[model samples]
Target: MILPEIKREGERYFLSSFKLPDKLTFAGQPIPLDNWQVRERIEYEFYQFLEDQGESIILAKRTGRCFPPAEKQLADAGLPDDLKYMLLVESKCVAAAYSKAKASGPWQFIPSTGRRYRLKSDAVRDDRRNLEMSTEAAVKYLRYLKDFEQNDWFMAMASYNAGEERVRRLLKDQNITDYWKMHGPRETMRYVPRIIAAKEIYSQPEKYLGLSKKDLYMPMETETVTVNVKDSKRALASIAEEFGTYFLELKMLNPEFKKDVLPRGTYQMKVPRQTCPSRCFKQDKTP
Candidate 1:
């Protein structure tokens, strides 16, 4: 999609006549657009997103493949549909995504956070890299934060970017009730506005960036099978050979397994059901 360009002068770039929508809502709650500070912050991020159209296109394309299942999961978990954009904002919906701070996966859970939420990260497996597991962990954490923040989704989202206790302390100490009003770290300050701008562009790609829903990449038709295995690596190789798929295909589909060996217990595997051969059966009996 061709994105709008920013014009520049001798010292600084500008979107001179560009302006944000008259009103905006995030996660079913209205952003206080009457506040010039709120409008300026969100507009700044929108300009930033426009400045990186190449990367934004990549993110939008990925959303096609990464969004559906997680969208369903979010709906099932009773989260607002717009919150799905958090995955995009967090890690660009990349399962292999890793940040400099050691946050990993689409949900960007740091090691300690992953452990607290039962997302195991070890030599053999980092559930933080697993889409399903990490997504559940994110939702669980969001829900907990929501409750703690007195059902305010904005506060929960801010705490997600910043530390929960830090935000809480700021809120209490400053006697501030609004997330936008509370002072926090730099990243936390920009986090919500970034997500809001992303959601706007993503949902209306054609309007904003000359791209349609057809440009999105949805997941392929696949099914998950439960199988008991002794060795992860060897078992995957065997399964790949049996199904006429590469080890990487299965590996990509199941990002939780970090080691070469598949574990001994029952594990769920996603396979392309239609394209897989009839002999591509679930492996309940291990050799």
Candidate 2:
């Protein structure tokens, strides 16, 4: 994953030549490759992805663990598979990732939007950090955006990055259904292209970097158990002890818990498979 060297003669750095595919489709919509501006923008981001070898390799590795469940969710929801790539562009698949805009998780959901999609954020827990919960919310939100934008995936995704209200106004004011033609904030403009670029590089990592199956991270196998802490707050260390594990292991599985002591509630928690003793076992769960 060595960084591609940029050539410099005196003051200017020369970018290495990289070519785009003759035909490209994003979210089943044909990219207007004939349009020079569109081609240039996508190619710019493509080269940006290619040159940043370290980031590309990390994304390649993360795909093994992060992409499967989300892709299955998208398929089950009847959404385009490419929509999963938004997670990569949004948070680079980091579960604990947070943005300056207060967006959090792999799907980069802000607090309000997370609530709208049934992802709760309280003092004890931020469900936005849970991959399954957040992905479910993202799938629902993207479906809403797609319907709102009249089945245009790019416009739907643009709305995902920029607020839907802003994209709605841009559509009406500009009178353009085509996302390529709309002029909005710089980040919104680049957002879809960045996802497209990510999709391209991720789809064919061997073309850009050296990687193997062993280098990629596989998802951990875990079992879920329900713990009801009725009318009393409990420290995570004590809870971990109940499962014959440690505080760090419990935290790794349940990053949503904000602190060591969680408020009284029934929690469905993940722990290493077979870690719980027979005395504690009642129902079996998988993750």
**Highest lDDT against the true fold, candidate:** 2
Best candidate, TM-score-wise?
A: 2
RMSD of 2: 5.3
Clashing pairs in 1: 64-217, 64-218, 65-217, 231-262, 232-261, 232-262, 233-260, 233-261, 233-262
Q: Over the stretch 1-287, how does candidate 2's per-residue lDDT look in tens digits?
A: 44456443454333354568889998899998899989888988988887776888899999988998898999999988988889889999998899999998889999899989999998888999999999999999998998888999999999999999999899899998789999999999999999998888787766555576777889887789788887678998988877756899889888888899878889999876664444343243222
Worst 10 residues of 1 by lDDT: 276-285
Write down the lDDT of every candidate, Cα atoms only: 0.80, 0.85
Q: Estimate each model's TM-score.
A: 0.85, 0.88
State how far residue 171 of model 1 sits from its true place (Å).
Answer: 1.7
User: Across residues 191-245, which tens digit of lDDT does each residue of candidate 1 receive?
Assistant: 9999998888788777655578888887876787665676533567776655545
Worst 10 residues of 2 by lDDT: 278-287
Q: Quote the lDDT for 134 in model 1.
A: 86
lDDT of prediction 1 = 0.80
